[model samples]
Target chain A: MNVRIDTYQQAVSRILRFDRVQRTAHWANALLFGILMLTALLLYFPGLSGIVGRRALVVNIHVWTGIALPVPLLISLLGPWGARMRRDLRRVNKWTRDEIAWLWALGRRAPRVVDKFNPGQKLNSLFVGGSIVVMLATGIVLKWFQFFPVSWRMGATFVHDVLAFAIFVVVIGHIIFALAHPESMRSMVKGWVTEGWAARHAPAWLREETGEMEEDQSVAHSD
Target chain B: MTTTAKGAPDQKAGVTIAVGRRVFLGMTALGLAGIVFGARLESVLDSGLQRLFPWWPGFRIYSISGSYPMISEAEYRLEISGLVDRPRVFTLADLKAMPSTSFSQEFQCVTGWTVPNVEWEGVKLSDILDEAGVRQGATALSFESYDGADSESLTLYQAQLPDVIVAYRMLGAPVTTEHGGPVRLYVGPMFGYKSLKWLSAIRVVDQVIPGYWEQNGYPLNGWRDGSTGPTDLALTGGVA
Candidate 1:
């Protein structure tokens, strides 16, 4: 068996490619977003809105936060970080033969070391994309009730709030996976992975980009 | 490209895979549709639910800085006094003597629901202030609601929004008792809080003092559209 050490520049560029900072910022926003939605739900109970004092303050904060929620996400998108993240996440998804085999042998084999994103990632991309759209549409409707009829506005509030809880669960899953896999977190945070890690996980990527092969043992030994 | 690959596309596995893809796509489409319905549904539910149950506080068109279970217009009279060279007590009819301005705009409650485009016809608060010839150094206006439901104060500076009118008509009809009828002050451009329904008296104050709601906890000036204030005034003041 042979393996090669991919160059530091090549490995670093590939890992550093996406707007990971924007991803972090987006995740950070989920906390406040959840708080706003939940409080709005609380205000819906009978005898609550006019309970006056803290309840009313909570209600006010909920509305103000709802109005403010989209601002950070919108600003992040206009920045370079947001644009690059959009570009990288849109990478055409292809499964190599080895990955196909991994899929076939799912229960029989240990999880494969992976480069970039795995199958679950593609699904997550879809989930987050769809989630954002739903949250944005429903959220604004709830926030700006005067823009629509009362019947329609009421419905928007219901949907906006229930979906917020759903997003909360999804975000938890995402964080758990990130923690369970330190390598994934490291790549995002540091924007680089050692050559050995790449050779084991993303051999094809390493080969394609560096014109080097794991078959080159001497280079691997040097690293 | 290989014999093994050809063999792998067997009937049972291929059928399952194709069915799985169909199911996945179907689920995605359903999810997308659900989200659309969800977004629209929340608003629809809020209004439909309100229409079904109009008596709910969030849906009630008759609430302002004061108490409820209010007095009738026959018994209701508005007194304009304090620092005005002349003090006068006028029945609801006297208020009708003044020219009125009416228009419809959204009335936003702090609790996240707004009744949109409420058509109101009433005297402009400005008309009354001008008639009273507000004395200089009268920095604030105090409002007294009939039925003694609410007594609230606002700064003259804050009361000057362009759409602030002392509304009398709602939706092309005379305002009903249930809707602050006989004559309610509709501060159109201000938050529903400032629109003090069941209004009965206007007093000019020398200083900007917080009134019933403001003193309790509500913001000093509740101008909807993201007003920064406490939830609402403590509900202890007399009727509106």
Candidate 2:
């Protein structure tokens, strides 16, 4: 009974980390990217293809899923409901000195205050956005191969193949990182995080969000 | 502002960036190995995996619409007309009754991927044109399919290539309906699209009339070697 009360108190102190638009877009990306990966695997591995022989259907699904990859995020960014996501986008695009320092201080655990989105997250989002555009363009050329020159087809195939492998690895890495930072994952999933968790990991953002600061000293932990 | 170099996520950030670097590098490495689809891949993949997984190189069945037109063997007729002394409507049995030419080669698609060693048997297109004697000025053969959407053409010279057959059998069996069967044109030297599936008509024309894919963006002469098809192949495979 005492533990339950403590848990309730902690929940009461939880911060709203992600808005509805942000959560929707994140989950949408997960679902679409999941489907794209599954279809892509079915298309790529010949052994796998034998088990499920309706390649035309699999290919159509993969292609349409790829074409639709950016829709949810694009929709989320366009509407009034996307206001918070837009603000977060600005934060993701901007780089703080500490974010840069955090990137450089790789091997050693150094002292730096964190923001809502770290530089690594920004890089990831950038790659995902850029790759979507590239993959779509190259994918079109692949489907309508007659229009372009053979060399363009070859180059597009090369780039598309390279980007696909890159996207797969990046997605895997993103999942691993998200799982590693369960508090962060919960923030994205439930749109909230425990105040203590945010305070520990993202002190500057916590202070900015809640307007709370320890006047005597920085709450930045020097690991 | 005071959020300066106050501190860092030395634990999560370091691990994240390190993993990020490896992922990027891994992609670069895999990319170096590279990927080439279609017949070009025959060198890299054909020997072992092709035997193990023959269906690895796939064929895309296409028509103007996303579907094919169904014409049973009994209902099918190939009309050979225009600028000819003897224009003939050949039933599947008629074409099969003629002395057949059978050969095995890759059915290469312009989009890449190849169906390899596809055994095709039918009378040579030239033999049919000889039977349906060409008029004085006829210079090209225009082909239309039963679907009425897909069409293709070859010049008089290309039409006479020894390897170009009006195929009735593929894969050692009667060509099935889904594969444009009963009787279809198969031009071995050119891309698979040149072989009109579910063939319905062959019109001998005075000049070239670009077919369906040609009306789109495909080169009218879709040589598998990526050159002027029969012109180059003429030295060996060409017949008068």
Identify the leading candidate in terms of DockQ.
2
Off by over 4 Å in 2: A1-13, A17-190, A193-223, B1-42, B51-54, B228-240
Supply every candidate's count of residue pairs whose N, Cα or C atoms clash at under 3 angstroms.
38, 6
lDDT of 1 by residue, B1-240 (tens): 121132233212221122223334554465455544643544456566667666432443323322243567677777889878677886767778888676768776532456656788877777777777888777778898764656667667555555777776887897766556677777654556566767788898887556665554546555554433354332211111
lDDT of 1: 0.57
CAPRI band for model 2: incorrect
The C-alpha lDDT values of all candidates are: 0.57, 0.73
Report, for candidate 1, the interface RMSD: 10.8
Please give each candidate's TM-score: 0.42, 0.64
Q: Please write out the lDDT profile of model 2 over residues B1-240, one tens digit for every residue.
A: 222222233233432223334434454443333333322444455567657755444555554444456787888888999999988899988987899999999887676556668999999999999999999998888999887677888898888889999999999999876667878899988888789888999999988888886765566787776563323332232332
Model 1 lDDT per residue over A60-158, tens place: 677677666656666666676575454334321334344445557863553343434554565455565555555556555545444544344444544
Candidate 1: Cα lDDT at A102:
55
Show the lowest summed lDDT stretch of 10 residues, model 2 chain A: A214-223
Cα displacement (angstroms), candidate 1, residue B110, comes to 1.8
